[model samples]
Target: MIRLATVIDTFEADFLAQYRDQLTPDHYRALAAMKHCRTQASPMMQVKCTACEHQKLVPHSCGHRHCPHCQHHESQQWLERQLKKQVPAEYFLLTFTLPAEFRTLAWAHQNVVYDLLMSCSWETVRTFSQNDKPLQGTPGATAVLHTNTRRLDYHPHVHLVMPAAVVDGKQKQWRTKPRGKAKGGYLFNHKALAKVFRAKILAAIETAGLTLPARYPQEWVVDCKSVGSGESALIYLGRYLYRGVIQENDIVACANGQVSFRYRNAKTTRRERRTVSGAQFLWLVLQHVLPKGFRRARNFGFLHPNCKHVIALLHVLLKCVPGQTLAWVKQRAPILCTCCGAVMAIVRTRIPSPFTGQLPISIAAEGNP
Candidate 1:
């Protein structure tokens, strides 16, 4: 498998030369973190074995959210938290996509546009739920912003994984969408959803003081499809939530100034390979680096962190077991002693990197043998 760090190290100079003027601080930061992740240039941790007292210094992960080399623990924790709030109802995955004509505008003002996209999508859904005859109440949703397509193109979209349920705060009631006889079980009219979503987002952009493109698509795209139980949908979204856009294992080869990676084509449902100049590939990946401190995933309505009691009550009333539906997240494997085979525990962390011109203080000097 080709590592992202290897690709970054090889193509960084060319990438910088080609796009230096276009690079943002977030892009530079992501490049640096992914390049040194788990390498000798990164910080180190000292661990000692329980049985044999064998001590070792391990390189620490950079822990950047965009670094594909790390954050497995964080990703799993997020999935677990979402799973804990799962309710026994049919769920739907709703996707709202920005028109191609708006790409340049979104790229120039990402934080504003992205936030508006998410907020507008949620607001559209909330509006629809309140107006629906059966569910005249606010609905809960978990929205995640994705900035790349399967081929790593700069396509910004927001996906909302929402249960078919709504909570009436005033009436103190919970109601689920009546399952329709349609083929996949209906949630809402996709066409109507697209219409409302388009208006809301366009108005939102103008309200935010951004110039609207003179020629934009009259019809935007919004897809709503049923995903049973919602656990699988949450897991799918969680996979790329912390890890970078492209997985390292998907990168098949890098040779002859070109990098090749594979992605499953969404429409064709088949695996396909795309090869591009190393510099171009780097640009494709780095262009997706979100603004510093911007949240890519969020919970709204009842799935929010502040609604634990509400979720807990629903779980009891509906007889839903949160973690029981999905397989338990396995604990991280413990470091083992080569001498005695016992587990090793971290004794110290944040040791200076060798590249920093400071020697890591010996663990033995800290009074441990």
Candidate 2:
């Protein structure tokens, strides 16, 4: 596998020279962290073997959310939390996409535009659920914002995993969409969903004091399809939730002045490869680096963190077992000692690099009298 750090180290100078004017502080931060992640240049921690009196210093991971080598545990934790909140009802995955004309505007004001995209999408679904004859109440959803397509293009959209059920707080009841023989299942009319979503987002953009693109399409695209049980969809979204846009395994070749990577085509459902210059490839990945402190995945309504009690009550009311449907998350492997085959426990951290003008504690003690 071609590591992203190797590519970054190889093309750093050229990439910086070409794109320095356009790079943001977040992009620079991500680059610096990824370039040295788990490498000797990063800080180190001293770990001692539990069984034997042996110690060694290991390089620390960058812990950046965009670094592919880190945050596997966090991604799994998020998935488990979502799984625990699952209820016994049909689920749907709705995609609300910002049109191509709005890409430039979204890039310029990503914080505002992305926030509106997710919030407005939930609001649209909430409205439809409240107005529906069967489910006349508030609905919950787990919304994830995806800024890249399968080919790593700058396409901003929000994918919402919503159960076709609503909680009527006023009536103190739970209601689910009627099941029929319509193949996978059915929810709201997707065409009507598109219309309402378009109006809400367009109005929201103007309300946020941003100008709409003059040549934007009159019709926006919103896709809603049934995902039975919703476990597989959640797993799919969790795959890239904490990791960066592209995984290292997908990076097939990095030779000469160009890099190549593969992606599964959404239309054909087949693997396809794209090759671009090294600098351009770095830009393709870094361009999706979200702003600092910006959240990519969010829970809303009954699924919100504050509403845990609601989820608990619904679990009992719906007679749904939390862990029955989804498979258990495997525990992370512990770092073991090479000498005794025992788990190593960290004793110290933030050991300075050799280039930092300060020597590590052990090295400094050795030099002293």
Candidate 3:
């Protein structure tokens, strides 16, 4: 499988050499980070095998949020934290997608449009959950912003993980539909949900001083389905929410100035191959760096940070012991060798020469636990 670093190393120079003046600083920074990730440009550490006494230098990860190499470890860490927040409750997955028209707006004003998509989509769900027949109470939800589709196109959408049963406002208890009522545990009407979400988001766009063509499509897309278990959905969504647009497994080949990848087409329900020049591939991947400090995944209702009291009450509702707990655990680095499958120790860190124009890094000898 072809890694993103390989593609970036192959074509980042040409892409930057040709379009540096046209690209923004953030784009340049993300591309440069990807190109230099886990390379000699980054810091290196010397590791010695505990069993074989083999010593080798390995480059450290750049740890950019958009880097595919760095995000798997981060995503796994996040999944653990998110899993601890889960309650023993049935959950639903709801997706609110932007139409093709809004993708242009999102590209131009990502912060504003993306925030609006998240807020407006949540509001649409919250409002309907309060007023709809099947759902009469508010449901705790965590909305994750996804900027790319299966085809890796600039498709901005929000996926919400919400409780299948709503939490009562007055009673502070979880409630579900009567046993004979909604058969599928659905929250609201799909077409109706789409209409409301579109109207609200369009109004938000107008408020942002952008006007749309009057001839745009009347129907929008809003999907709602029961995920049965909330933890599984959270794990799946966490991976996509924290990672790069395309995975290394999707990459088929990189040679002769072209990169080829595969994507499962939604309409055709079959795998399809797409090949593009290395420069074009790098540019396409860089398009999803996102604005600096934009919080893509956010919790709402009882899960938010400011809702400590509400969270305690929720724990009571779930029969969990009530106490403020640290959920985000520190992630530990691996000691095992990637190549030889042997235990290893960090014997020292390699410091680049000052004359070479690289920043100084610490050198330390540490044994693996």
Candidate 4:
């Protein structure tokens, strides 16, 4: 189970020792947390089996959103929740990308820029959905902020999971039918999407006192592709919610103060490996660590948590059983005994002594000593 954390745990102290002055508190904190994550530095709990009387110690995860190791459970929970909100209609994956001129500043002003990106994307979807020519109903969308390009470059963009169908504003009834009997199921005008999206993004930039080059293209990149059935796509996109720009599985090698990892070539559609210094690799991952308490995924229109009643009404409109959604998201307990087939219960729990970085000798001596 060698992972990115293994490299981090081994090399991060040296990286920090050399580059501490150049890093931020968040970067230092993230690296420290990841280094100690699920290791001796973290707290542990003692769970005992009722039948076999066997005891086990489980370490606590740092549970930081950017920690790739800890966020798998969060991703699953999000996927199931989004699936339950699915309607019997078409779905669209809309990506609103910043212009080339904006990437550098967008990284520097991440919170402001990303918030504006999400807002503009939501507004674009809302406005287009409300156009009388299309339908007067509002569509629900969830926006995911992505800060890395395929090459792991610092390119900030937003990925939106939006439905092709819109619902009546007041009635909350479906305003769209199955897109087409065949393959031509177009949702919105891509040209117009590009136009509106660019306009909103530029306006937001100016409003926030941010500047873009005057010679920049009038149209920013807006990708709108209809995912055949959104259930799988929505679930697939859920991976980005809690993960870093890349995953542990993507790492190919880590040695000699360098790290190599694979990425799918966006243009050639082929796999490629990239190698960089350990410090640079740490920088690549840390830059995407969001501001504390900043949300990476957001629900807009009816999918919002504030409008749960609206979601309930929509569920009724779509004929979804209340009980079924729970079945879709049943969380499994973690403490299972292996020696005898029985459930384990937490007999005692406490943080290990910070000074010694170890649990009490009485408990530590029992299991693996």
Q: Give the Å shift of residue 125 in candidate 1.
A: 0.7
Tens digit per residue, CA lDDT, model 4, 1-369: 357678886567666666656565566567766766777678787889988899988877777788877877788788777876776667889988888888777767878999999999999989988884656778888888888886777788888887777768677467764576557477777789889888988888898998776668876678887886576567657776786778888888888989898888978999999998887787788877888778888998878777788777877767865345444454645678989879999877765835334332222334421
Candidate 3 wrong stretches, greater than 4 Å = 17-22, 46-57, 133-135, 178-184, 267-269, 308-316, 320-333, 337-342, 345-369
Q: Which lDDT value does model 3 have at 23?
A: 65
- Superior by TM-score: candidate 1 or candidate 4: 1
Global Cα lDDT for candidate 4: 0.76
Question: What is the TM-score of candidate 2?
Answer: 0.94
Give the per-residue Cα lDDT of candidate 4 at 58: 81
RMSD of each candidate relative to the true structure: 5.5, 5.2, 6.5, 5.9
Q: Write the per-residue lDDT of candidate 3 for residues 171-287, one digit (tens) a residue.
A: 756666543356556666789989999999889889988766555688999998877657667877876666678878898999998989898897998999999888877777878
Count of backbone collisions in candidate 2: 0
Q: For candidate 1, write residues 215-297 as lDDT tens digits.
A: 99788789999999888789889999999898999999999999999999999999999999999999998899999999999
TM-score of 3: 0.83
Clashing pairs in 4: none
Per-residue lDDT for 11-99 in model 2, tens only?
Answer: 87788888877887788778878888888888899999999979999988889999888888888889998999999899999999999
TM-score of 1: 0.95
Candidate 4 weakest ten by summed lDDT: 360-369
What C-alpha lDDT does candidate 2 achieve relative to the native structure?
Answer: 0.90
lDDT of each: 0.89, 0.90, 0.75, 0.76
